[model samples]
Target: MTADKKSITALIIDDDQMVADMLGQILQDAGLNTIITFDGKSAIKLYLDKKPDIIFSDFLMPEINGVMVLKAIKALNAKIPIVLFTGYYNQLMDELKGEIVKPDRILRKPFIQVEKIHDLIREFFPGYEIDA
Candidate 1:
């Protein structure tokens, strides 16, 4: 196992418990050690402690938003990968570039393709295996 994949921890930050749970399950199935948080601040703490290989965060949350979380995570660990799970795509990359950790990928909310998720994980950790 590649060190990055084996160390591939993912944090899902969203206010909706269901969304977080759903993404967490998907990430787990993709062979990642997953952590789900409800807000950016908590996600920041989790990211700092876990130093996860990737993060999937909701763009808009009741409290701290994904942008803030991204900034915090980048400030702590610039190399860690983050994905913004969003329904609102307008100005997403442009607006977030300076404020948060630029996500390697954008996963639309309620993603229809699990394979795409798998692809993202694979993209980050090329040697990791995915179960059929």
Candidate 2:
């Protein structure tokens, strides 16, 4: 489906409340609907219920990590685009090697720009154009 025709729903998962709120705001500003979860455990339940078009999850969480979250979501919908965000990008990438469930993208922490978020949406949902 074309991006214009596709419904953009984003699931933002991060243990840090501030980070989740920031990402949610960015997605909202980009004209996409979003659901924010502070933990991976709840995120899985939310994912099942909401079935968002894309997901942004922090690699490190209290109990279930981002990789685990991705696996759980993949079990339900393998095609969903999941981006793993972490401060320790290199460490997480190294840990994810040889893993069956992999993230579609990796985002570094302290995400600075809304444009990067838009780019991610545009990447997954082709034809998506930001409204001025």
Candidate 3:
């Protein structure tokens, strides 16, 4: 299903406040509403409560990590596109291999580009334009 720009909501989970805020701003600029969370424990609750159109979660976090968060969300809604962002990309991917709940995309921390984020939104919501 194609989501219109105004109707799409993005859930951004990151232990670091700066990263979460930056990602939220990027999403908002792209015309998607965003909800930011600081931990996986709260991430799940927000996910269920908000039922965002898409999710972007940091791979490493206290209590529960991105993988765990992905599993929890998948258990509730398998169709939601969840992108896991981490600096330890190789190790995280190895751990996630053959998992029942896998991320739609794994973006490397310190390397993510605004264009890539915009591209992901376009992938899920075709015809939606990113603000210049």
Candidate 4:
């Protein structure tokens, strides 16, 4: 079944408030509802409660990390798309090598290209219209 465009939601987990807000705005511009959390623990809780259509999460955090978040969410909903964000992309990739549970995508920090966020929304939720 196709997701109702208006009902589409995105869960954003980032310790950096600025990055979280930036990502939230990008998703909102793509016509998505967004839930932002500063930690992976709260993110998992939000995931169960909201069941967002997609997820964008930071790779490093206290208590739980992106891999933990990815594995936890994937266990419940494998079909949901999840992207990981990190400043240490190469290291994270090396660490994830051979891992069964992995993010659908990994993005590097200093998000200069706003289009990447729009592209992700388009890739995962093609029905949603992105604002130019």
**Predictions in order: lDDT:** 0.79, 0.88, 0.90, 0.88
Best by the lDDT measure:
3
Q: Lowest-lDDT window of 10 residues in candidate 4?
A: 123-132
Error of 1 at 17 (Å): 1.0
Candidate 4 lDDT, 41-111, residue by residue in tens:
99999999988989999998888999889999999999999999999888888878998988998899977
Q: Model 3: per-residue lDDT, tens digit, 17-84?
A: 99999999888888889999999999999987888999999999988999999999999999999999
Q: Which candidate is the best by TM-score?
A: 3
For candidate 4, the per-residue lDDT at 50 reads: 86
Compared with the true structure, model 3 gives a TM-score of 0.94
- Per-candidate clash tally: 0, 0, 0, 0
Q: Give RMSD to native, each candidate.
A: 2.2, 1.6, 1.3, 1.4
- Please tell me which model should have the higher TM-score, number 3 or number 4: 3
Candidate 1 structure quality by residue, lDDT tens digits, 2-59: 6454567888889989888888888787777888889888888877687777888898
Better of 1 and 3 by TM-score: 3
Please give the distance, in angstroms, between residue 10's alpha carbon in candidate 3 and its true position after superposition. Answer: 0.3
The runs of at least 3 residues in candidate 4 whose Cα sits more than 4 Å from the true structure, single-residue gaps closed, are 1-3
